[model samples]
Target: MVSQENGNQSQQTGGRFAVTLPLATLRGVGVQLGGRDILTDVTAQLRRREVTALIGLNGAGKTTLLRALLGEIPYSGEIRFDCVHGNRQQPGHIGYVPQRLRIEGNLPLTVFDLCGLSLRRWPWFLPLGTRFRERVYAMLDAVSVAHLLDTEIRVLSGGELQRVLLALALEPTPELLLLDEPAAGIDFHMQEEFYGLIGRLNRERGVTVLLVSHDLTMVSKSVGHVWCLKDGQIECEGSPHDLLHGDALARIFGSHQGVFGHRH
Candidate 1:
């Protein structure tokens, strides 16, 4: 039990903590599409310098919830960011890498072009000065794709394309990074390498990461916290060890038990 004055002090302390830290808060978040609730009454708090994984079966609304956070989908909720300093509206503040990188038509856009797209505020189309070129090269180098700067996008493999997309997302040095199945459809080695890079990015950049993935093994090892979604609701959320113990996983994902099996 807590006293009234103590509760007030605690609340004040919590507010101060929020203001000081680089965190994002979502309260009573709900998303409905086509008269169907895809996400209902979901509440989550993402802290800075930590990785949060969104894990669940297909159609569990993980991607939908992420989209809502990006303001791409209409949602009933409050998303407050503790934007330190004056760099709040910058594009690099929230970087997103979508699931697929399929671009149709045979446009001869090079890797440099893909990276240059991130420089929307620049007046010239291509990277003109040494500073801009260095920045692009640095981003490509960070993803280990600098050698392919001149390679055409249409000619790159799936894994190569994913790297380029990641480079684009990291161009602005974003505070919050959202990755949707960054390892999907790639080979096992590439997946491992990508995870290593993501881990380093989180650790070194102090970037808050939110990952939506179906790979339970990787999710269990990589993230500090996991939010398991089912039927448009958060079924359970905790550390992997706590949530994946014995029948708890079975309860969240019953007979169809695969990586993130659906209960039925």
Candidate 2:
């Protein structure tokens, strides 16, 4: 078992893989879609084994910031991941779970089919061999969705599908896990359970998590650090206790009254 001291050191060093290397850095990050600024001058650093929550309103550019971090969208910024081994030519270090994955019913695929697709082997359509099958089963068991391995994608509910996606993402044992509202659209009870699972993963696997969430209450309970966004900018950033009990939340989101409550 990994000791707490080791975990803390791993986190301080930005995970085991990059422990000896310089930390990952994001500087002056900015993004614009169709001449509209979605993320402006956003900068942050992600440490290993730390859960960072990105919170904001419906259109506060949280999703845009996540995309920018993944390099999925063009943006002006420097995202540098320093590898201790000096091997920068790999694609499995970062794992991403997208929000609202629209799986088409017409696609003839099973849960196992999607999970096997995560393998980095050539010819993605090739059938999984015994070794790969074992790996797939292990991943399914890890996510507690082994029973759904044979289930059809079209038949699974939202929460089941999300678990399948998480299993696929974890197959690579990514150093950095990026989740965009993993609990959205699920039932209230399931949301609570899902956050608990997420918290466990962070604590046990030492996977650094950065989640973009609008559920402030849930996020407050799950994450260690919070970065609140508003109008394409960071309104406030600190611990959940610091932002919630103080005037920071009221200043950013209190004036805009609704069921959503304060912003930060």
Candidate 3:
């Protein structure tokens, strides 16, 4: 593991984009839950306009780190956001797509209703205005799900639901995007397409992405940087080619290989 003091000094490459700025920096960040140290002396940087994959075992605190960065949980040390000029509080906007949304299968919630709940400030009883509906449609259209606008959320497939959630997250154009296993239940082909969409967004709009994933093969293809977390701290970080090949993967993952399969 890289020591906290030396973590920030590690080199970062942006792959196709040539990005070098640090979008977010974590220094000596620690998280404790139920009197147990969930994370100790964690330090890392999420490069601006780049896709970073956070990979590890199931209980390695990958989601915990994301929650800490989102300010959703209490943590020690500092998480600084350099999204805007002279602003140190937080990013101007942060788009988040969680692992899953637990909605009752019987609930009569349409895609428009789901989007409106977040996008529209008005109460659900109020009729959605024409302009608001248009904005929502356009957002869905960008993700190629506009046809599902009136479709019930419960009836949508795993991939469709993910796309809808992604659309909701993209609005207002966030400087940072946090995805916790965004493609968890989707089929492999759809997962590839989804990652492609994410990569396209990073390249086109310059959105910095911090992705938590277990699919090492997909991680290798999708992200520019990979951070392997183990026992609640970063064990290794580098490009996929540097960290995911040969003995490096075995060193980081070890007995947890069954969780995420790979040819190498």
Candidate 1, clashing residue pairs? 92-174
Pick by lDDT: 2 or 3, better one: 3
User: What RMSD does model 3 have?
Assistant: 4.4
Q: Write the per-residue lDDT of candidate 3 for residues 126-176, one digit (tens) a residue.
A: 998999999999999988899999999999998899999999999977888
Q: List the residue pairs that clash in candidate 2.
A: 253-263
Q: Which stretches of candidate 2 lie over 4 Å from their true place?
A: 1-23, 83-90, 259-264
- The numbered model that scores best in TM-score is 3
Deviation in angstroms for 202 in model 2?
A: 1.5
Candidate 2 global TM-score: 0.84
Would you list the rank order by lDDT, best first? Answer: 3, 1, 2
Per the 3 Å backbone cut-off, how many clashing residue pairs does candidate 1 have?
1
Ten-residue region with minimum lDDT total, candidate 2: 1-10
TM-score of model number 1: 0.84
Backbone collision tally, model 2 = 1
TM-score of each: 0.84, 0.84, 0.88
**Candidate models: Cα lDDT each:** 0.74, 0.72, 0.82
